[model samples]
Target: MSKATSPVRFKAKLLRPAKPANAAWTFLLVPKAASAKLPSRGQVGVEGTLEGASFSAVLEPDGQGSHWLKVDNKLREAAAVDAGDTVALEVTPSGTMPEPTVPAELRKALAAAPEANAVWADITPAARHDWIAWITSAKREDTRTRRIANACDMLATGKRRVCCFDRSGMYGKGLSAPEAM
Candidate 1:
């Protein structure tokens, strides 16, 4: 991993969701202009300081064309800020895929199913990222296991991306999103 250093800097105002929405995100939405300056238009590993507290995250798309960096509760408290605050961001690439942590269950399933494993390997890195994101995003273990099973099935059937999932991966496949509505 490359050392964290000065990165493309920007100022953006944090905003609350208009209503109850997908639990998948709660991220800091990086502006389009800032996003355009980054190396990858797809999911990227990034680290920066928000409100003086440093953070690490993946810049993902919101199914729309724009990108966002997820800010979990721990970061929010550490930063001493909340929605409606303007934040300073210094984003640098980590020189690795941001969301590549695959679950053990999914790995076993993939190993057992050659066709699915072949399809998994055949898909683009971006697609694999989406699948992993969906499987990991589930709040419950059962939900995650179901997602893993579903992913294997879909891959075996020659499907590339998950339904309702996109570049940002804020919402898992088959889950309704307020962002989309």
Candidate 2:
């Protein structure tokens, strides 16, 4: 049988506490269809504006058929979200492409290259940001090739812009082999 898939959208109210609490809550959003499967951990993404600050979170299932989200500090501080302020949740089947595995040799080369580090440190943060965004955004082979080439050129001069090295270090120590990809 084919797997069932559909976008789920819902409105949720933020519940505040009577006192400042470090704990977060697990509020539920009923799926639009009874047969609609709730997203598993790392299968959900959120985008919204709260108290004039916008943020996004990737929801990860806690394995109990419940979802948990880690909100950025900006959203938490701006909203002053308490036990009862209403928040909205919209979940859709993400069309995200799987990230390609950057070869370990390339990662090690970048890490060990003193020139690369010097160049990377010289670049502005915005340039680094753009480089990272470009590399991670591409899912196609040609795009990946272009990004890698661009990165190589940047790193050859010891200039780290953004994508000069795999900052996440998919090949480095302590990472599970499965998670490396």
Candidate 3:
């Protein structure tokens, strides 16, 4: 097996739900261990098993010296955990894996739009991942360019992936949007 896929093991406690909205589920987390070597934000291919069910999560650093393991909601439901369940976390370090390189033309276009870059940088890695995935998956260049332009416009205006346009056709700012585009 490739070293890139090797898993690291750690013990974690399921944190108690901070609010009632999250009370239905629990989180098994690595919560900033001073001695633990955790992955940084945007690291991919992280895997773990919670309650005997294996799952994958993306590691995102909170910038306060801690990282979050973003597991899918379906997996969370399957685990039947509540806030504060002690569990184990296993993850593979993000290796020298190649990511889809942005086309030169697209890079130039993005570079020309400073506001877009600023907004894009401010977004979460997961959101950026979605945009990259969409653009790279397009079978045609025209579609990709159009989507890129739209994405740039959305970023410049600080609108997220889904909430760029509201029901009234007006854009709202400050945390109502997904910021994942």
Highest TM-score scorer: 1
Q: Residues 9-63, candidate 1: write the lDDT tens digits.
A: 8887666554456442245677777777776555777777887788777677654
Clashes of each: 1, 20, 6
**Predicted candidate 2 versus true structure: per-residue lDDT over 1-181, tens digit per residue:** 2222554445555433322345343233333341134433223444445444555544433233334444444566676764445655544444432232345534554577666656655665434444544564465767766775667677766655553333223322211111100
Which is better, 1 or 2, measured by TM-score?
A: 1
For model 2, the superposed segments whose C-alpha errors exceed 4 Å read 1-7, 11-42, 46-53, 77-80, 97-181
Candidate 1: global Cα-lDDT?
0.70
TM-score of 2: 0.33
Quote the positional error of residue 121 for candidate 2 in Å: 19
TM-score pick, better of 2 and 3: 3
Evaluate residue 98 in candidate 2 and report its C-alpha lDDT on the 0 to 100 scale: 26
- TM-score, candidate 1, is 0.59
Clashing pairs in 3: 14-84, 14-85, 15-84, 26-82, 127-180, 160-179
Between prediction 2 and prediction 3, which has the larger lDDT? 3
